[model samples]
Target: MVTVSAEESLDHGVPAPMRRGEVFTIHATRDDRSMITHRILPEIAVAQARQLNDAGWQVHISELGGRAFKPSEFYQLLSYKRIG
Candidate 1:
């Protein structure tokens, strides 16, 4: 029989999907000190960004890895429309 510790078991575990309205902070690649906060729009915005084939857009909730989304959190920054 094999035994696994809690830390070992959690090592391969995947994170849960992000929820709506969650805030993701975007950092400028050139300037580490600069960051922009963005709230995740509805699911529809994600779908729409994908349909447009804009894969570079990403939504980062924290300081770590970011998830890709079309018309992503960054998109909101570029758009003049009010986001909820």
Candidate 2:
């Protein structure tokens, strides 16, 4: 498993410390595409992912420093609003 420093995890767009093995969630968007990835705490991540998925987003659960990770997930959850 890839270990993430406390500074690397985030909550609510704010940088905060995370436990050694703690994971978090990240939402990303580009043009008309969007996905939610998890580096998330299972307690909350799963629920959040399900919620986003229910809203029609592609949700993925991944490790903190695992493959397919985008650095931006550590920053924020992007808007997934659909266009007309």
Candidate 3:
């Protein structure tokens, strides 16, 4: 079995760090335990989103600007309005 690091892995090795909203991609796959592992394909986006928690970024696959992932059944996209 092979493993890859997260999208930001390369950035950490370079002298320059990534901005909070920077995006990158590597490869992603499902492991033998049926757990999905993100390989961080080098062409995808990894932008910061307040919608996310401490990681503060959103990662998803897309083609033609639409979701490439199978629809979620166990989770729903929660929406909230910033009432400030």
Candidate 4:
């Protein structure tokens, strides 16, 4: 028979995936500032930027999630920023 403590069991567990709009936990000093990132698609970002620009919102930042993937569906998770 074997027994495991709650702490031991939790230590071996993997963290859940980051949700769409969840703020990340960052290690920083009291005076430091950081961004809470979210995954956004590249094409969508571009289209949205153009739309927002036309509608009167100026975009200033955009970033991608990962590389151009094989399936291509994953490329949708990339992001971009533009100045409108």
lDDT of 1 by residue, 1-84 (tens): 122212211112333223323333332222233334332432333343344334433323331235543233534433443332
Candidate 2 lDDT over residue span 9-42, tens digit each: 3334322223333455446454597655544344
**TM-score: model 2 vs. ground truth:** 0.40
Compared with the true structure, what per-residue lDDT tens digits does model 4 show for residues 1-84?
122212211111222212233111111112243222222323443444345345544333222222222222323333323212
Which candidate tops lDDT? 2
Model 3 C-alpha lDDT per residue in residues 1-84, reported as the tens digit of each score: 333354332323322212222222212333332222233331222221112212422223322223343223102112212111
Give the better candidate number (1 or 4) by TM-score. Answer: 4
Residue 5's lDDT in candidate 3:
52
Model 4: lDDT to the true structure? 0.29
lDDT of 3 at 80: 18
Report residue 60 deviation for candidate 4 (angstroms): 2.3
Q: What stretches of model 3 exceed 4 Å from their correct place?
A: 1-4, 9-33, 42-66, 70-84
